[model samples]
Target: MAEEELKIEEGGKKGKLMIIIIAAVVIIAGGAAAFFFLGGSDDDMADVQAVEGQAGAAPSASTGSAKSGTALYVAMPRPFVLNVPGAGRDRLVEIKVQLMVRGSDSEELAKSHIPLIEGTLLQVFSSSNADDLVTEAGKIALREQSLRDVQAKMQEIAGADVVEEVLFTGFVMQ
Candidate 1:
């Protein structure tokens, strides 16, 4: 009877060991599957490397003739919030902006001058009336004005168009 009990205990241990091994195998397989599905593709890596190469070269200026490495976006650190005069009453306005650049150099340049850019955007946004902001055409005109002003400022500082677009990712007026 003792021998029979010992054999039973050994069998239970073996079953547990088998379960652990199977669990390990399943976990490893899941990890490999995720890696394959989520890893960056070769094309993405090549584009990143190309941009890095251009930035590392330290080009004197990003001229129109130079190839734009990649489209990159730089987000302003904070949203612009201010009050604008309306037809009836003053309303609070908030705008979140992102700058799109053609290459790494432009990205860096824009990042370095974020304060200036923010100020420029604030000036443009504050100049608008709340009533006009209610219309789609007014928003488009504001965006165009912002882009032109930012580009002009960048050109003054860097002698190149560092920002390609001024995107209003978020806008609210109340």
Candidate 2:
């Protein structure tokens, strides 16, 4: 009876030992999981800080670009009117615009090409109907044609490829 009681007590102690070991393992595993998923302290935020610094350094590069635009503005000509085809019957029938243009080639670039661009635009606008001069789609189409016409005219006048883009400073239809 004594030996049997001793064996029973030893079995209880073994069970308690197993419980302790399991609890310790669970605690260690949970701590490791927490560190792996949610404990990223400063390394994650460093990337964002570095990106902000890089973006801050770019303004100096853009500051000089505004000065270059002064010359472009001086060379740009008057606004041209495109009479909408369907506009005769509608309330808003005209696309009035002022163009800001530049050249593609440095040597071929000439401020004098503004007249040629204006002339080409006058012809292009006059040929377009109301449907081609009204609405968002019409506006985009007109802008594209204006760019093409200006570039073509610039090439013809300077005897080389010139004119980059035509910006619409004033775009209104009424």
Give one digit per residue, the lDDT tens place, for model 2 in 31-93: 999998987768778986676565442222212221122223333445565545564553333
Clashes of each: 0, 6
TM-score of 1: 0.65
lDDT of 1 by residue, 1-174 (tens): 999999999999999999999999999999999999999899999998887786653333546322356677999999999999998999999999999887667788889999999988988998998998999999999999999998888889888878888999999989
Q: What's the lDDT for residue 90 in model 2?
A: 37
RMSD of 1: 4.6
TM-score of each: 0.65, 0.46
RMSD of each: 4.6, 14.0
